[model samples]
Target: MANEDRPRSKLLTRLHLGTDEPLEVVPFLDDTGHGVFATRAPSRPNRIGLSIVRLAGIDGARLSFEGNDMVDGTPVLDIKPYVPAFDVRHTERIGWFAERLGQLRGKLSDGRMR
Candidate 1:
């Protein structure tokens, strides 16, 4: 095996859910490629959260996803990369979330990157 076949960079991630949530990834089944998972339920169906966050900085990461929250049962799945040229959609028109994209600069843990 060669180093080139290995991942150039890697991510250390953790996905979380609240106490009221009822679900489990159990050996993390049905995982597609790689993504985040909230191991608990939500206050609303859409309220996802991070119990802890960290990013490996050797690749050009702008921020490490961490801080302001902590709990033991959180389940983090996978981590990817940030590529501005390939990731940003400059020409696309925004709907209701148009103004909200800026808030995404602080949001991560995987499922929202694309």
Candidate 2:
């Protein structure tokens, strides 16, 4: 099947060095102290990141995708078909995010990870 015809997928990528600090605790965008696992802060113990994107097309070894948030030349570690049945979770608790969902709409990176 053509790439565009395929379903959306997930990319496991190595974060660029700009946000690759191994920080145990970092202030989230909201200025709350949170452990690395509790927030999407880029300074994790491991510099891996997961991005969900729509497959736009492929030419030879290059992949085109929508919903890209990484910089160009970002190293992709792996790709997996996005199966909502397995990836989606019906959770009542999202920890701190549960109370902060309303603030997510206009939030943007402030370069705090660097």
Candidate 3:
């Protein structure tokens, strides 16, 4: 956890479901498959991950937080203060995730890749 008071910290980490192998690219941009880059699935070439969470509280060395996506014991690669100017974006198309928006509320990690 960070030493300073960063109420909104975005955790950059190496996702547990990712692998150390090279990523094979799909043939063409017009391909209809679920391209690796298009989805936020845990698998990636470099295994880097990101999660924006709210800091609930802080004491000596422990931290209380909310909106944690990664599992317990997830290794954090970096922590940066989220600046709206650089991070926020206005877009209408959210791709495949938009179709699943209604199903997210009760969704739970199935631990399939891990």
Candidate 4:
């Protein structure tokens, strides 16, 4: 099928239903598909993987996500895949974020990232 004719894939926006209370998305800093922060603390945090979401194979991708912005196990409302063919840019900078990646990796591995 042609690109325009092909059906657009929709990401499954699942709420972390295994809880007493409901949580929603909290916008933070990042061009990456609107980072979702934790609205409230949960007994057991979990990740709601969006169909478009992917673990950044880049050196520091995970660290950025694991930073203080997102708490353990938050339900993401949406995700849009970064189509490198279109999203890639000739110029890009790691910014101040590169520094925090190490700390993020430590905390994030404990019990985060879906």
Give per-residue CA lDDT, model 3, range 1-114, as digits (tens). 563455678999878756544344321222345666776656677678899987878798766667777777778888888888888999999886676677667666544544
- The C-alpha RMSD in Å for every predicted model, in order, reads 13.2, 3.3, 6.1, 12.8
Model 4 vs. true fold: TM:
0.25
| Ranked by lDDT, top first | 2, 3, 4, 1
Which stretches in model 2 have alpha-carbon errors above 4 Å?
1-6, 18-22, 25-28, 111-114
Q: Per-prediction TM-score, please? A: 0.29, 0.78, 0.70, 0.25
lDDT of each: 0.37, 0.76, 0.69, 0.38
Error in Å for residue 46 of model 4 = 24
lDDT of 3 at 23: 46
Q: Please give, for residues 1-114, the per-residue lDDT of candidate 1 as tens digits.
A: 343333332333343442333333221222322211423223323444433233323346343333423344444444555444555567576443454456556554444212
The TM-score between candidate 3 and the true structure equals: 0.70
lDDT of 2 by residue, 1-114 (tens): 765666889999988764545555555446667768887765677878899898888899999888776767889999998999999889878887877778767765566533
Q: lDDT (0-100) at residue 13 of candidate 1?
A: 31
lDDT of 1: 0.37
Count clashes in each candidate, considering only residues at least 3 apart in sequence or on different chains.
5, 0, 0, 1
lDDT of 4: 0.38
lDDT over C-alpha atoms for residue 46 of model 2: 80
The 10 consecutive residues of candidate 2 with the worst lDDT sum are 20-29
